[model samples]
Target: MGFSVRALDTDSWAAFAELVEANNGVWGGCWCMGFHVKLGKGRTAQQNREEKEARVQTGDTHAALVFEAEKCLGWCQFGSPDELPEVKSRRLYEKGLTTLPDWRITCFFTGKGFRGRGVADAALGGALAQIAQYGGGVVEGYPEETDDRKVSGSFLHTGPMSAFENHGFTRTRPISPHRWVVTRTV
Candidate 1:
């Protein structure tokens, strides 16, 4: 079956929640809040879950959820820097960040048993399209390059460099050993 994409609003919360629950609250109780202001530090999984759910209800969080037959397979999380300020290699990132993009693709999550099936790509495409609908502007993402060696999927929540490049994002700067700040005007 073909994949479908939807905005992560109240209506899609159940599906998104199911995916997170299945993944053990996602990367140890993150609920995809690692980049959000909350950070979920010293918080319980249920606490993070509740916080994320509340944000979803109020339409504060943003993501493109990819689904197959009513089961959400994955998602690409994106929002303004204000909405998602926390990031890896923060010091290096701020040093070279000349201007913040209108939207930032913070991370991605593919459901178990659905990896390597183009879910992340679909989520990325859906996110850029949605960003355009909201008035297109520059978009940014931090993705790792895996040209010389293989990187585990679990460590790729930020996404892969190739996916952004495929969507027209260019290599702007490097923040970590393998991760780089990539951008494109969506």
Candidate 2:
């Protein structure tokens, strides 16, 4: 079957929730809100789930969902800088920033049995296309450069450098030892 993608809007909420639930709420119940909101101390997974669900219901969150014949297989979260407040290695990323990007690709999640299947790449492409529909602008992403080393899929939730580059993003700067700030003018 061919892969397809869609924005994670109200109509697609059910499929997106199913994908997150299948992954154990994503990164210990992050619900893909790690960059969008700061988790207070003692925040429960259920709370995070509730908050994310609310965001989806109110059309506050943005993401691109990858699917194969109607079943969502993965997703990539993208939004404006204000929409996604904090990111990994914020200090380092700030040092390299000449100007704030119009959009940021913050997180990615692929289903358990769907890793290494180009789900992330498809999602990234989908995200760029979605951004274009809103009038294209600079899109930034922080992804790891594994350098052929052994790395777990869980550690690549933000995605990998190669995937972003393959989608036409250039390495703008190094945000961390293994992570880079990449961008593309969409």
Candidate 3:
């Protein structure tokens, strides 16, 4: 069957959370909020999870999820400009990174059993098309590119270089040796 995508809603949070934890547990509990939320000062992992869920529920329709038939297969985080403080607050921003008023693609997670079936690519394509439906502007993705010889889940939260590039994203800047800022101007 074909892969389909939609914005994650409150009703689907359980499945979404499950996908995150299941993948994160084996990959290390990144929780997908490691860089986005402050989990250090005093908050615990559980608290961070709650906060992220709350944000997902109350925040604008930003995050997109993919499904194949009845199974949730992948997810891609996207939304308006200010929704991603983690990326905006980075040192790269201070160094003159351009900002678009539309949405940005920040994180991606393809479920354990659905990694290499073109799930991520299909989800990303669906996300871009969905956002564009409402006049979404340029889409940006900053994925990490670790040595292919030693690749693993932990090394790819933002995504991989070839994935974004294949989806029409071009390298805008090198955020790090492994991470790069990519953009597709609409």
Candidate 4:
């Protein structure tokens, strides 16, 4: 089935919540806010959900949500450097960061039973298209490169190297053994 993509705007908040809820709040109550908000003590899944919902309601949420008909199946989060303070590898990324990217693709979350079926690729493409609408610039992403090694879907929240490459992103530098900073001048 073909999919449609849209920004995580107020109108789409319900669909976004449904997708995240289906995934158990996404990575242990992350609510796709790992790069946007710091995790703290006493945080609960409900709190995360509420915070994310508030962000969406206030138009602060920046993500591309993929829908097969009306069901949200996947998402790709993107934002300006200031909006996303930290990434997976802060130190390494900082070392190679000569300049901040106009936008950063921080995370991807595909619903259960929907992975490995081009959901992520669609999300990334949707994100780039949205960025282009806002006047494109340097877009950065940090994705894991397994190099033929077996890796779990849970470990690919930032997405995989091949998906980024498929969307025209090139490796800028290595952040970790299996993670690299990829970029594209979209």
Those runs of model 3 whose alpha carbons end farther than 4 Å from true positions after fitting are 24-30, 98-101, 146-149
lDDT of 4 by residue, 17-46 (tens): 888888888888889878887877888888
The TM-score values for the models, in the order shown, are 0.96, 0.96, 0.83, 0.97
**Candidates sorted by lDDT, descending order?**
1, 4, 2, 3
lDDT per residue, candidate 3, 54-111, as tens digits? 7777855456688876677888777765666567337864475655536678778888
- lDDT score of residue 13 within candidate 3: 78
lDDT of each: 0.91, 0.89, 0.72, 0.90
- lDDT of candidate 2 over 128-148, digit per residue (tens): 999999899999999999999
Instruction: Specify the poorest-scoring 10-residue window by lDDT in model 2.
Output: 36-45
TM value for model 3: 0.83
Candidate 1 has an lDDT of 0.91
Error of 2 at 123 (Å): 0.3
Q: Which ten residues in a row have the lowest lDDT in candidate 3?
A: 25-34
In candidate 3, list every pair of residues with a backbone clash.
none
In the order shown, what is each candidate's alpha-carbon RMSD? 1.2, 1.2, 2.7, 1.0
